[model samples]
Target: MELITEGIKKAFILIFTGDREIFEIMLLTIRVSGISVIISMILGIPAGLIAGLNNFKGKKFVISIINTGMGLPPVAAGLFVSLILWRSGPLGFLNIIYTPAAMIIAQILIASPIIAGVTLAAVQQINPKLKYQAMSLGANRWQVLWILIREAKLPTLAAIMAGFGGVISEVGAVMMVGGNIKGQTRVLTTATVQMVRMGNFDIAIALVIILLFLTFAVNLVLTLIQQKENITWAQRFWR
Candidate 1:
Protein backbone atom coordinates (compact mmCIF):
# COMPACT_ATOMS: atom_id res chain seq x y z
CA MET A 1 0.00 0.00 0.00
CA GLU A 2 2.80 2.38 0.88
CA LEU A 3 4.66 1.47 -2.30
CA ILE A 4 1.57 2.09 -4.40
CA THR A 5 1.03 5.44 -2.76
CA GLU A 6 4.62 6.46 -3.31
CA GLY A 7 4.47 5.29 -6.93
CA ILE A 8 1.38 7.36 -7.61
CA LYS A 9 2.99 10.39 -6.04
CA LYS A 10 6.09 9.92 -8.14
CA ALA A 11 4.00 9.47 -11.30
CA PHE A 12 2.13 12.72 -10.68
CA ILE A 13 5.41 14.48 -9.99
CA LEU A 14 7.04 13.22 -13.16
CA ILE A 15 4.00 14.20 -15.21
CA PHE A 16 3.42 17.59 -13.56
CA THR A 17 7.09 18.47 -13.44
CA GLY A 18 7.32 17.91 -17.22
CA ASP A 19 10.46 15.84 -16.79
CA ARG A 20 12.42 16.00 -20.04
CA GLU A 21 13.58 12.40 -20.12
CA ILE A 22 10.11 11.08 -19.51
CA PHE A 23 8.71 13.36 -22.17
CA GLU A 24 11.28 12.19 -24.71
CA ILE A 25 10.67 8.54 -23.95
CA MET A 26 6.91 9.06 -24.25
CA LEU A 27 7.22 10.83 -27.60
CA LEU A 28 9.61 8.24 -29.01
CA THR A 29 7.31 5.46 -27.87
CA ILE A 30 4.42 7.03 -29.78
CA ARG A 31 6.49 7.74 -32.88
CA VAL A 32 7.92 4.26 -33.24
CA SER A 33 4.72 2.45 -32.37
CA GLY A 34 2.61 4.69 -34.60
CA ILE A 35 4.94 4.21 -37.54
CA SER A 36 4.93 0.47 -37.02
CA VAL A 37 1.14 0.39 -37.00
CA ILE A 38 0.94 2.37 -40.25
CA ILE A 39 3.42 0.11 -42.02
CA SER A 40 1.62 -2.99 -40.80
CA MET A 41 -1.74 -1.72 -42.01
CA ILE A 42 -0.32 -0.76 -45.36
CA LEU A 43 1.09 -4.22 -45.92
CA GLY A 44 -1.54 -6.25 -44.09
CA ILE A 45 -4.80 -4.77 -45.37
CA PRO A 46 -4.35 -5.62 -49.03
CA ALA A 47 -2.88 -9.01 -48.33
CA GLY A 48 -5.71 -9.87 -45.97
CA LEU A 49 -8.35 -8.51 -48.31
CA ILE A 50 -7.00 -10.52 -51.20
CA ALA A 51 -6.70 -13.67 -49.16
CA GLY A 52 -10.19 -13.32 -47.80
CA LEU A 53 -11.81 -12.61 -51.16
CA ASN A 54 -10.04 -15.16 -53.34
CA ASN A 55 -9.75 -18.91 -53.27
CA PHE A 56 -6.54 -20.50 -54.38
CA LYS A 57 -4.69 -23.79 -54.07
CA GLY A 58 -2.32 -22.56 -51.36
CA LYS A 59 -4.74 -20.29 -49.50
CA LYS A 60 -4.80 -22.38 -46.36
CA PHE A 61 -1.01 -22.34 -46.22
CA VAL A 62 -0.99 -18.56 -46.31
CA ILE A 63 -3.65 -18.29 -43.63
CA SER A 64 -1.78 -20.76 -41.43
CA ILE A 65 1.32 -18.63 -41.74
CA ILE A 66 -0.64 -15.54 -40.69
CA ASN A 67 -2.20 -17.31 -37.73
CA THR A 68 1.23 -18.57 -36.58
CA GLY A 69 2.63 -15.06 -36.83
CA MET A 70 -0.24 -13.65 -34.77
CA GLY A 71 0.92 -15.78 -31.82
CA LEU A 72 4.64 -15.21 -32.44
CA PRO A 73 6.62 -14.77 -29.24
CA PRO A 74 8.07 -11.28 -28.82
CA VAL A 75 11.49 -12.64 -27.82
CA ALA A 76 11.55 -14.83 -30.86
CA ALA A 77 10.62 -11.88 -33.03
CA GLY A 78 13.46 -9.95 -31.40
CA LEU A 79 15.94 -12.71 -32.21
CA PHE A 80 14.80 -12.96 -35.81
CA VAL A 81 15.02 -9.22 -36.33
CA SER A 82 18.38 -9.11 -34.61
CA LEU A 83 19.80 -11.79 -36.88
CA ILE A 84 18.62 -9.97 -39.99
CA LEU A 85 20.06 -6.65 -38.84
CA TRP A 86 23.32 -7.99 -37.42
CA ARG A 87 26.56 -6.40 -38.62
CA SER A 88 27.45 -9.26 -40.95
CA GLY A 89 23.88 -10.23 -41.74
CA PRO A 90 22.43 -10.20 -45.27
CA LEU A 91 20.81 -6.76 -44.98
CA GLY A 92 23.50 -5.19 -42.82
CA PHE A 93 24.54 -2.72 -45.48
CA LEU A 94 21.62 -0.51 -44.45
CA ASN A 95 23.18 -0.35 -40.97
CA ILE A 96 20.02 0.15 -38.93
CA ILE A 97 20.87 -2.09 -36.03
CA TYR A 98 20.70 -0.62 -32.51
CA THR A 99 18.70 2.27 -33.90
CA PRO A 100 15.13 3.52 -33.76
CA ALA A 101 14.73 2.26 -37.33
CA ALA A 102 15.65 -1.21 -36.14
CA MET A 103 13.13 -0.96 -33.32
CA ILE A 104 10.44 0.07 -35.80
CA ILE A 105 11.31 -2.84 -38.03
CA ALA A 106 11.00 -5.31 -35.19
CA GLN A 107 7.70 -3.80 -34.13
CA ILE A 108 6.39 -4.01 -37.69
CA LEU A 109 7.21 -7.68 -37.73
CA ILE A 110 5.36 -8.09 -34.43
CA ALA A 111 2.26 -6.17 -35.53
CA SER A 112 1.79 -6.94 -39.24
CA PRO A 113 0.60 -10.49 -38.87
CA ILE A 114 -1.89 -9.58 -36.18
CA ILE A 115 -3.33 -6.85 -38.33
CA ALA A 116 -3.41 -9.18 -41.33
CA GLY A 117 -5.19 -11.95 -39.48
CA VAL A 118 -7.77 -9.69 -37.93
CA THR A 119 -8.37 -7.98 -41.26
CA LEU A 120 -8.87 -11.35 -42.91
CA ALA A 121 -11.49 -12.24 -40.35
CA ALA A 122 -13.21 -8.92 -40.78
CA VAL A 123 -13.33 -9.17 -44.57
CA GLN A 124 -14.43 -12.77 -44.47
CA GLN A 125 -17.32 -12.02 -42.15
CA ILE A 126 -19.00 -9.74 -44.69
CA ASN A 127 -21.86 -11.21 -46.74
CA PRO A 128 -20.89 -12.44 -50.17
CA LYS A 129 -24.11 -11.13 -51.70
CA LEU A 130 -22.80 -7.61 -51.18
CA LYS A 131 -20.06 -8.34 -53.65
CA TYR A 132 -22.52 -9.71 -56.17
CA GLN A 133 -24.80 -6.74 -55.70
CA ALA A 134 -21.95 -4.31 -56.24
CA MET A 135 -20.98 -6.07 -59.43
CA SER A 136 -24.58 -6.11 -60.55
CA LEU A 137 -24.63 -2.34 -60.08
CA GLY A 138 -21.79 -2.05 -62.64
CA ALA A 139 -19.05 -1.50 -60.10
CA ASN A 140 -15.56 -2.21 -61.33
CA ARG A 141 -13.18 -4.41 -59.34
CA TRP A 142 -11.55 -1.45 -57.56
CA GLN A 143 -14.91 0.10 -56.80
CA VAL A 144 -16.19 -3.16 -55.40
CA LEU A 145 -13.18 -3.45 -53.14
CA TRP A 146 -13.58 0.09 -51.89
CA ILE A 147 -17.24 -0.49 -51.11
CA LEU A 148 -16.53 -3.68 -49.21
CA ILE A 149 -13.76 -2.07 -47.25
CA ARG A 150 -15.99 0.83 -46.30
CA GLU A 151 -18.63 -1.64 -45.19
CA ALA A 152 -16.12 -3.32 -42.93
CA LYS A 153 -14.98 -0.05 -41.38
CA LEU A 154 -16.13 -0.94 -37.90
CA PRO A 155 -14.23 -4.21 -37.69
CA THR A 156 -11.30 -2.63 -39.51
CA LEU A 157 -11.20 -0.04 -36.74
CA ALA A 158 -11.05 -2.94 -34.29
CA ALA A 159 -8.12 -4.33 -36.23
CA ILE A 160 -6.39 -0.96 -35.95
CA MET A 161 -6.98 -0.98 -32.23
CA ALA A 162 -5.53 -4.46 -31.87
CA GLY A 163 -2.45 -3.72 -33.96
CA PHE A 164 -1.78 -0.45 -32.17
CA GLY A 165 -2.18 -2.05 -28.76
CA GLY A 166 0.14 -4.93 -29.64
CA VAL A 167 3.14 -2.84 -30.65
CA ILE A 168 2.71 -0.02 -28.11
CA SER A 169 2.96 -2.47 -25.23
CA GLU A 170 5.81 -4.51 -26.72
CA VAL A 171 9.28 -4.43 -25.13
CA GLY A 172 11.37 -7.48 -25.98
CA ALA A 173 11.83 -6.92 -29.70
CA VAL A 174 12.43 -3.18 -29.30
CA MET A 175 14.95 -3.73 -26.53
CA MET A 176 16.85 -6.29 -28.55
CA VAL A 177 17.06 -4.31 -31.76
CA GLY A 178 17.24 -0.84 -30.22
CA GLY A 179 19.85 -1.65 -27.49
CA ASN A 180 17.76 0.60 -25.21
CA ILE A 181 20.11 3.55 -25.80
CA LYS A 182 19.00 6.54 -23.74
CA GLY A 183 17.88 9.61 -25.71
CA GLN A 184 17.95 7.42 -28.78
CA THR A 185 15.87 4.24 -28.75
CA ARG A 186 14.75 3.84 -25.17
CA VAL A 187 10.94 3.80 -24.69
CA LEU A 188 8.40 3.49 -21.92
CA THR A 189 8.15 -0.31 -21.86
CA THR A 190 11.93 -0.79 -21.93
CA ALA A 191 12.43 2.00 -19.41
CA THR A 192 10.08 0.31 -17.00
CA VAL A 193 12.08 -2.92 -17.30
CA GLN A 194 15.35 -1.13 -16.67
CA MET A 195 14.03 0.73 -13.67
CA VAL A 196 12.70 -2.49 -12.11
CA ARG A 197 15.98 -4.32 -12.62
CA MET A 198 17.80 -1.43 -10.90
CA GLY A 199 15.38 -1.55 -7.92
CA ASN A 200 13.72 1.79 -8.65
CA PHE A 201 10.19 0.60 -8.19
CA ASP A 202 8.76 4.09 -8.02
CA ILE A 203 10.21 5.03 -11.37
CA ALA A 204 9.07 1.76 -12.83
CA ILE A 205 5.56 2.35 -11.58
CA ALA A 206 5.62 5.84 -12.99
CA LEU A 207 6.80 4.56 -16.37
CA VAL A 208 4.09 1.93 -16.35
CA ILE A 209 1.46 4.55 -15.65
CA ILE A 210 2.73 6.69 -18.47
CA LEU A 211 2.58 3.73 -20.78
CA LEU A 212 -0.98 2.93 -19.77
CA PHE A 213 -1.98 6.53 -20.12
CA LEU A 214 -0.49 6.74 -23.58
CA THR A 215 -2.19 3.58 -24.70
CA PHE A 216 -5.50 4.78 -23.31
CA ALA A 217 -5.18 8.16 -25.01
CA VAL A 218 -4.54 6.65 -28.42
CA ASN A 219 -7.28 4.09 -28.03
CA LEU A 220 -9.67 6.74 -26.83
CA VAL A 221 -9.24 8.66 -30.06
CA LEU A 222 -9.73 5.55 -32.13
CA THR A 223 -12.74 4.56 -30.07
CA LEU A 224 -14.33 7.93 -30.59
CA ILE A 225 -13.87 7.56 -34.30
CA GLN A 226 -15.25 4.07 -34.16
CA GLN A 227 -18.39 5.05 -32.25
CA LYS A 228 -18.96 8.52 -33.57
CA GLU A 229 -22.30 7.81 -35.18
CA ASN A 230 -23.62 6.04 -32.11
CA ILE A 231 -22.48 8.88 -29.90
CA THR A 232 -24.11 11.44 -32.14
CA TRP A 233 -27.33 9.50 -32.14
CA ALA A 234 -27.33 9.30 -28.34
CA GLN A 235 -26.77 13.04 -28.05
CA ARG A 236 -29.68 13.76 -30.38
CA PHE A 237 -31.97 11.51 -28.32
CA TRP A 238 -31.00 13.21 -25.06
CA ARG A 239 -31.39 16.67 -26.60
Candidate 2:
Protein backbone atom coordinates (compact mmCIF):
# COMPACT_ATOMS: atom_id res chain seq x y z
CA MET A 1 0.00 0.00 0.00
CA GLU A 2 2.77 2.40 0.92
CA LEU A 3 4.72 1.43 -2.20
CA ILE A 4 1.69 1.96 -4.38
CA THR A 5 1.03 5.40 -2.92
CA GLU A 6 4.62 6.47 -3.36
CA GLY A 7 4.71 5.16 -6.90
CA ILE A 8 1.54 7.02 -7.80
CA LYS A 9 2.84 10.24 -6.35
CA LYS A 10 6.08 9.86 -8.26
CA ALA A 11 4.28 9.04 -11.45
CA PHE A 12 2.16 12.17 -11.19
CA ILE A 13 5.24 14.26 -10.56
CA LEU A 14 7.15 12.74 -13.43
CA ILE A 15 4.30 13.15 -15.86
CA PHE A 16 3.36 16.65 -14.72
CA THR A 17 6.92 17.86 -14.79
CA GLY A 18 7.46 16.42 -18.29
CA ASP A 19 10.45 14.30 -17.49
CA ARG A 20 12.57 14.28 -20.63
CA GLU A 21 13.63 10.65 -20.51
CA ILE A 22 10.12 9.44 -19.84
CA PHE A 23 8.77 11.48 -22.72
CA GLU A 24 11.48 10.24 -25.01
CA ILE A 25 10.91 6.62 -24.16
CA MET A 26 7.16 6.94 -24.48
CA LEU A 27 7.41 8.63 -27.87
CA LEU A 28 9.80 5.99 -29.12
CA THR A 29 7.46 3.26 -27.94
CA ILE A 30 4.57 4.86 -29.81
CA ARG A 31 6.64 5.27 -32.94
CA VAL A 32 7.71 1.65 -32.97
CA SER A 33 4.23 0.31 -32.22
CA GLY A 34 2.49 2.66 -34.65
CA ILE A 35 4.80 1.69 -37.47
CA SER A 36 4.33 -1.94 -36.58
CA VAL A 37 0.55 -1.48 -36.68
CA ILE A 38 0.76 0.02 -40.15
CA ILE A 39 2.93 -2.79 -41.36
CA SER A 40 0.63 -5.38 -39.82
CA MET A 41 -2.38 -3.78 -41.46
CA ILE A 42 -0.68 -3.98 -44.79
CA LEU A 43 0.44 -7.57 -44.50
CA GLY A 44 -2.20 -9.12 -42.30
CA ILE A 45 -5.56 -7.35 -42.77
CA PRO A 46 -5.69 -7.73 -46.54
CA ALA A 47 -4.52 -11.30 -46.41
CA GLY A 48 -7.06 -12.10 -43.72
CA LEU A 49 -9.85 -10.49 -45.69
CA ILE A 50 -8.92 -12.39 -48.79
CA ALA A 51 -8.69 -15.64 -46.91
CA GLY A 52 -12.03 -15.09 -45.27
CA LEU A 53 -13.90 -13.99 -48.41
CA ASN A 54 -12.40 -16.37 -50.93
CA ASN A 55 -12.64 -20.13 -51.22
CA PHE A 56 -9.57 -21.76 -52.62
CA LYS A 57 -7.37 -24.77 -52.26
CA GLY A 58 -5.15 -24.73 -49.16
CA LYS A 59 -6.96 -21.70 -47.73
CA LYS A 60 -7.48 -23.44 -44.41
CA PHE A 61 -3.84 -24.37 -44.41
CA VAL A 62 -2.90 -20.76 -44.84
CA ILE A 63 -5.19 -19.67 -42.00
CA SER A 64 -3.72 -22.36 -39.80
CA ILE A 65 -0.29 -20.98 -40.55
CA ILE A 66 -1.40 -17.55 -39.43
CA ASN A 67 -3.01 -18.95 -36.31
CA THR A 68 0.21 -20.66 -35.41
CA GLY A 69 2.14 -17.51 -36.00
CA MET A 70 -0.02 -15.64 -33.49
CA GLY A 71 1.58 -17.68 -30.71
CA LEU A 72 5.20 -17.26 -31.79
CA PRO A 73 7.52 -16.68 -28.89
CA PRO A 74 9.06 -13.23 -28.87
CA VAL A 75 12.42 -14.53 -27.71
CA ALA A 76 12.49 -16.96 -30.60
CA ALA A 77 11.54 -14.22 -33.05
CA GLY A 78 14.30 -12.04 -31.69
CA LEU A 79 16.78 -14.88 -31.95
CA PHE A 80 15.79 -15.66 -35.52
CA VAL A 81 16.01 -12.01 -36.50
CA SER A 82 19.36 -11.75 -34.80
CA LEU A 83 20.65 -14.74 -36.70
CA ILE A 84 19.47 -13.36 -40.01
CA LEU A 85 21.13 -10.03 -39.33
CA TRP A 86 24.42 -11.47 -38.23
CA ARG A 87 27.53 -10.68 -40.31
CA SER A 88 27.52 -13.88 -42.35
CA GLY A 89 23.76 -14.22 -42.61
CA PRO A 90 21.76 -13.59 -45.77
CA LEU A 91 20.24 -10.28 -44.59
CA GLY A 92 23.36 -9.11 -42.82
CA PHE A 93 24.10 -6.54 -45.48
CA LEU A 94 21.12 -4.42 -44.38
CA ASN A 95 22.73 -3.98 -40.95
CA ILE A 96 19.48 -3.51 -39.05
CA ILE A 97 20.33 -5.34 -35.82
CA TYR A 98 20.52 -3.57 -32.47
CA THR A 99 18.61 -0.52 -33.73
CA PRO A 100 15.17 1.05 -33.88
CA ALA A 101 14.70 -0.49 -37.30
CA ALA A 102 15.22 -3.88 -35.73
CA MET A 103 12.68 -3.04 -33.06
CA ILE A 104 10.18 -2.09 -35.74
CA ILE A 105 10.85 -5.30 -37.60
CA ALA A 106 10.41 -7.32 -34.44
CA GLN A 107 7.15 -5.59 -33.64
CA ILE A 108 5.82 -6.13 -37.15
CA LEU A 109 6.53 -9.80 -36.83
CA ILE A 110 4.76 -9.91 -33.48
CA ALA A 111 1.70 -7.94 -34.62
CA SER A 112 0.97 -9.23 -38.12
CA PRO A 113 -0.24 -12.68 -37.19
CA ILE A 114 -2.61 -11.40 -34.49
CA ILE A 115 -4.13 -8.90 -36.91
CA ALA A 116 -4.48 -11.53 -39.62
CA GLY A 117 -6.00 -14.14 -37.35
CA VAL A 118 -8.56 -11.80 -35.79
CA THR A 119 -9.53 -10.39 -39.15
CA LEU A 120 -9.83 -13.83 -40.63
CA ALA A 121 -12.16 -14.90 -37.84
CA ALA A 122 -14.34 -11.86 -38.42
CA VAL A 123 -14.34 -12.39 -42.16
CA GLN A 124 -15.20 -16.06 -41.90
CA GLN A 125 -18.31 -15.22 -39.91
CA ILE A 126 -19.78 -13.20 -42.79
CA ASN A 127 -22.33 -14.75 -45.15
CA PRO A 128 -21.01 -16.22 -48.36
CA LYS A 129 -24.21 -15.30 -50.18
CA LEU A 130 -23.48 -11.62 -49.71
CA LYS A 131 -20.59 -11.85 -52.16
CA TYR A 132 -22.78 -13.46 -54.79
CA GLN A 133 -25.60 -11.00 -54.19
CA ALA A 134 -23.23 -8.08 -54.49
CA MET A 135 -21.80 -9.39 -57.73
CA SER A 136 -25.23 -10.07 -59.18
CA LEU A 137 -26.33 -6.54 -58.37
CA GLY A 138 -23.89 -5.09 -60.91
CA ALA A 139 -21.32 -4.27 -58.30
CA ASN A 140 -17.92 -4.40 -59.89
CA ARG A 141 -15.10 -6.19 -58.11
CA TRP A 142 -13.82 -2.91 -56.70
CA GLN A 143 -17.23 -1.74 -55.59
CA VAL A 144 -18.22 -5.03 -53.99
CA LEU A 145 -14.91 -5.31 -52.23
CA TRP A 146 -15.24 -1.80 -50.89
CA ILE A 147 -18.73 -2.47 -49.59
CA LEU A 148 -17.65 -5.66 -47.87
CA ILE A 149 -14.72 -3.89 -46.20
CA ARG A 150 -16.80 -0.94 -45.10
CA GLU A 151 -19.37 -3.25 -43.57
CA ALA A 152 -16.61 -5.04 -41.71
CA LYS A 153 -15.27 -1.81 -40.21
CA LEU A 154 -16.20 -2.58 -36.62
CA PRO A 155 -14.64 -6.04 -36.50
CA THR A 156 -11.71 -4.79 -38.51
CA LEU A 157 -11.13 -2.10 -35.94
CA ALA A 158 -11.17 -4.75 -33.24
CA ALA A 159 -8.54 -6.70 -35.10
CA ILE A 160 -6.42 -3.58 -35.39
CA MET A 161 -6.71 -2.97 -31.66
CA ALA A 162 -5.73 -6.56 -30.95
CA GLY A 163 -2.69 -6.17 -33.15
CA PHE A 164 -1.68 -2.96 -31.44
CA GLY A 165 -1.98 -4.54 -28.01
CA GLY A 166 0.08 -7.58 -29.02
CA VAL A 167 2.97 -5.48 -30.23
CA ILE A 168 3.11 -2.78 -27.57
CA SER A 169 3.44 -5.22 -24.68
CA GLU A 170 6.14 -7.34 -26.29
CA VAL A 171 9.55 -7.13 -24.70
CA GLY A 172 11.63 -10.18 -25.59
CA ALA A 173 11.65 -9.66 -29.36
CA VAL A 174 12.38 -5.95 -29.22
CA MET A 175 14.97 -6.39 -26.51
CA MET A 176 16.83 -9.04 -28.47
CA VAL A 177 16.64 -7.23 -31.79
CA GLY A 178 17.35 -3.77 -30.38
CA GLY A 179 19.68 -4.71 -27.56
CA ASN A 180 17.63 -2.16 -25.61
CA ILE A 181 20.03 0.62 -26.46
CA LYS A 182 19.50 3.84 -24.52
CA GLY A 183 18.33 6.98 -26.40
CA GLN A 184 18.00 4.85 -29.51
CA THR A 185 15.77 1.79 -29.31
CA ARG A 186 14.49 1.90 -25.75
CA VAL A 187 10.68 1.50 -25.66
CA LEU A 188 8.20 1.21 -22.83
CA THR A 189 8.36 -2.56 -22.36
CA THR A 190 12.11 -2.80 -22.72
CA ALA A 191 12.60 0.40 -20.75
CA THR A 192 10.53 -1.04 -17.95
CA VAL A 193 12.81 -4.06 -17.81
CA GLN A 194 15.85 -1.83 -17.67
CA MET A 195 14.33 0.42 -15.04
CA VAL A 196 13.61 -2.59 -12.86
CA ARG A 197 17.19 -3.73 -13.12
CA MET A 198 18.28 -0.24 -12.08
CA GLY A 199 15.83 -0.11 -9.15
CA ASN A 200 13.78 2.74 -10.65
CA PHE A 201 10.46 1.27 -9.52
CA ASP A 202 8.53 4.51 -9.78
CA ILE A 203 9.16 5.14 -13.47
CA ALA A 204 8.56 1.50 -14.30
CA ILE A 205 5.24 1.54 -12.53
CA ALA A 206 4.33 4.77 -14.30
CA LEU A 207 5.08 3.24 -17.67
CA VAL A 208 2.95 0.22 -16.79
CA ILE A 209 0.08 2.55 -15.89
CA ILE A 210 0.35 4.35 -19.19
CA LEU A 211 0.51 1.07 -21.07
CA LEU A 212 -2.60 -0.17 -19.33
CA PHE A 213 -4.40 3.08 -20.11
CA LEU A 214 -3.49 2.80 -23.76
CA THR A 215 -4.73 -0.79 -23.97
CA PHE A 216 -7.98 0.21 -22.31
CA ALA A 217 -8.49 3.13 -24.65
CA VAL A 218 -7.87 1.05 -27.75
CA ASN A 219 -10.18 -1.75 -26.68
CA LEU A 220 -12.82 0.74 -25.56
CA VAL A 221 -12.83 2.38 -28.97
CA LEU A 222 -13.16 -0.95 -30.68
CA THR A 223 -16.06 -2.00 -28.48
CA LEU A 224 -17.75 1.37 -28.91
CA ILE A 225 -17.62 1.03 -32.68
CA GLN A 226 -18.98 -2.48 -32.51
CA GLN A 227 -21.84 -1.37 -30.27
CA LYS A 228 -22.69 1.60 -32.47
CA GLU A 229 -22.99 -0.64 -35.51
CA ASN A 230 -25.58 -2.85 -33.79
CA ILE A 231 -25.11 -5.61 -36.31
CA THR A 232 -24.85 -9.36 -36.05
CA TRP A 233 -21.58 -11.26 -36.18
CA ALA A 234 -20.94 -10.99 -39.90
CA GLN A 235 -23.67 -8.54 -40.81
CA ARG A 236 -21.52 -5.54 -40.03
CA PHE A 237 -18.45 -7.38 -41.31
CA TRP A 238 -19.78 -7.90 -44.83
CA ARG A 239 -21.96 -5.65 -46.87
* Highest-lDDT candidate: 1
- Candidates in order, TM-scores: namely 0.92, 0.90
TM-score: which candidate is best?
A: 1
Per-residue lDDT of candidate 2, residues 80-102 (tens digit): 88888876888999988888888
Model 1 residue 87 CA deviation in Å: 0.3
Query: Candidate 1 — what's its lDDT?
Result: 0.88
lDDT of 1 at 171: 90
| Alpha-carbon RMSD, candidate 1 | 4.4
Report, for every candidate in turn, its global Cα lDDT versus the true structure. Answer: 0.88, 0.85
Off by over 4 Å in 1: 230-239
User: Could you give me the TM-score of model 2 versus the true structure?
Assistant: 0.90
